[model samples]
Target: MKRLIATFVTAFLTCAAPVTAAELGDDGLHKTDWMRDTFKDLPEDLAEANAEGKRLLLIMEQRGCIYCDKMHAEVFPDPKVRQAIEENYFVVQLNLHGDIEITDFDGETLSEKAAARKWGILFTPTMIFLPEEVPEGATAAQAAVATMPGAFGKGTTFDLLTWVAEQRYLTDPEEDFQRYHARMIVERNNGNTE
Candidate 1:
C-alpha cells in the first residue's frame, strides 16, 4: 500500500509541474522571445514619419497583448515574412505602456508610452508604414502614408509586406489592397514579381 501511494503521488506531482510552469511562464505580457529582437522602440513623431528611400515599419504593441504575441510567434517568423520585412523596411517595436524613451528622426526624445499616446495608438500590433519624409515638427498631415492595425494572418501579412515593398500603396487605396495582393501572388507564381 505504501509503495502504491508513493507511486501515485510521484505521478501526480509530475503532471502538475508542467501546468504550474506553463502558468508561470506567461509573463502576464504576451511577448515572445523573437519580438525583442525583431521590433525596436521609436518615438511618436519618428514612428509616423517616413525614412525617405528607406522604408520604415512601426509595430505598436502593449504588454499583455495576446495578439501581438501571436503575430510575433506565428506570422513574423515565417521565412517569406521575415525576408520581406528585412528587405524592405526598418522595423521598430514600441511598447504602448512602457516607460522607455526614444528619439525621433527629428532629434526629439519622448517616452515610448508617451509617443504611443501622442499618435493615438490604442491597439497592439499596429503596423504604421512611412513612405516619405516627415518634416521636422510636422504632424500626420505632413506625413504621406498609412497605418495598418491588428494582428494580421500570414497570407495578409505577406501581402502587406509585398505591397509596401513594391510601393503599391502610393496610388492604391485601402480597397485595392486585396487586388494588389492577388496580383503579387500571380506575379510570384509566374516568376515575374520582385
Candidate 2:
C-alpha cells in the first residue's frame, strides 16, 4: 500500500510539472499587445507625427518571417525606440501576403502587399522612407527615398533612425552612416560613459 501511494504521487508530480512550465512560457509569449496594436492599418497616432512635419516610415512584413516577429517583439517595444519612431515618422504597417486596400497619394487603390511589391520590396521587414509629399500620380520608383530590408537590432535600428531623420543618406551614403551613428550615440549618451 505504501509503495502504490508513492508511485501515484510521483506520477501526479510529473504531470503537473509540465503544466506549470507551459503556463510560465505562455505568460511571456502570449502577451503581445504591442505588436497587436501596430497591425493591419496605420495607427491613428501617425497623424500626430504628420502634424510634426515628419516623413513616413512604411514597414512591410510577412506573417511567417521570424525577423519581423523579432522586430515587433524586441526592437519596437523598447521605450526609447518607440518614442523616437512615434515622434519622428508616420508609421504604416503592411502585411506582405494580405489583401487590404490602400489608396496611394496618386488616388490609385492597390492591395497593400501589391503596393509593396510595386516598390521593389523583395524581402520581409522592409522599411521604406517616404517624403512628406509624395507627388500625385508618382510611380513607386519616384515615391521612395530609401529602402532597408531584413531584421535589425535596437542599436542598428536607432542608427538607421537617426540617419534617415537627419537626411544623412543624401550627402554621402558610404561615410555618412558611421559619422551619423557616432553622433547619435554621443547625443544619446550626453558624455556619460555607458
Candidate 3:
C-alpha cells in the first residue's frame, strides 16, 4: 500500500510539473523533439502529418527575437503546451531569413524568407495551423485555419492549440476564436478570472 501510494504521488507530480526546455540552436531557435526536420514541402508535409494523424503546424521564428525567446523559455516549456504540440501537431519551423528552399501547397517554391514575405508574416513566433484538408491550388497561408501571431501566455497558447486540434473553427463557425477564448477563460478560471 505504501509503494502504491508512492507510485501515485510520482505520477501526479510528473503530470503537474512544468517541463524545462533544452538549449536553443545557433540560429536562436528552440529545437524541440516535437519539431519535424522535414523537406519543407507543404503538400508532402501535410500528407505525412495526415498519415500520422497530426495537424500540420508551420511556426515562423527569427534569430535573436526576444518574443521567440520568451515563447521558447516560458510558453512552449509548459507541460500542457508541450504535450499538446507533441501529441497533436506536426511542427515545421521556418527561419525568417533562412535560405532553405520551401515548396508551398500551391506548387510555388521559394526561400523561407520569400515565403514569409508572401504569407505576410510580420511577426516572429507566428504559428500557422492548417486544416486537415487543404484546398487545391491554395498557398499554405491561404489554407490556414488559424494563425497565432506573437508570444502568448501558457493558457492562451494551450487553449488555441486545443481549439485548432478540435477543429472548432469549422464545426462551430459562429463561435469565433475570440468568443471561444472568452468562454475558455471562464472555464479555465472556474468562472472567475480575478
What TM-score against the true fold does each predicted structure earn? 0.63, 0.64, 0.87
List runs of model 3 lying over 4 Å from the truth: 1-20
- Best model number under lDDT: 3
- In TM-score terms, which candidate is top? 3
Worst 10 residues of 2 by lDDT: 21-30
lDDT per residue as tens, model 1, 150-172: 88788789888777767776656
Name the better of 2 and 3 by TM-score.
3
Winner by TM-score between candidate 3 and candidate 1: 3
Q: List the residue pairs that clash in candidate 2.
A: none
Per residue, candidate 3 scores C-alpha lDDT tens digits across 1-194 of: 99999999999998897444656788767788789999999899999999999999999999878888789878888899999999999999999898899999999999999999999999999999999888999998999999999999998999999999999988999998889999999998899978
RMSD of 3: 6.9
Question: Once model 3 is optimally superposed onto the true structure by TM-score, how far is the C-alpha of residue 18 displaced, in angstroms?
Answer: 16
Off by over 4 Å in 2: 1-49, 170-175, 182-194
> Can you write out model 2's per-residue Cα lDDT over 1-194, one digit (the tens) per residue?
99999999999997775322111121122122223234333323334446767767777777656676677767877777777776677676666765877666555668887777776778878887776556667754367676779988887787787677777777677756767667767777895647
Model 2 residue 160 lDDT score:
84
Global fold similarity of model 1 (TM-score): 0.63
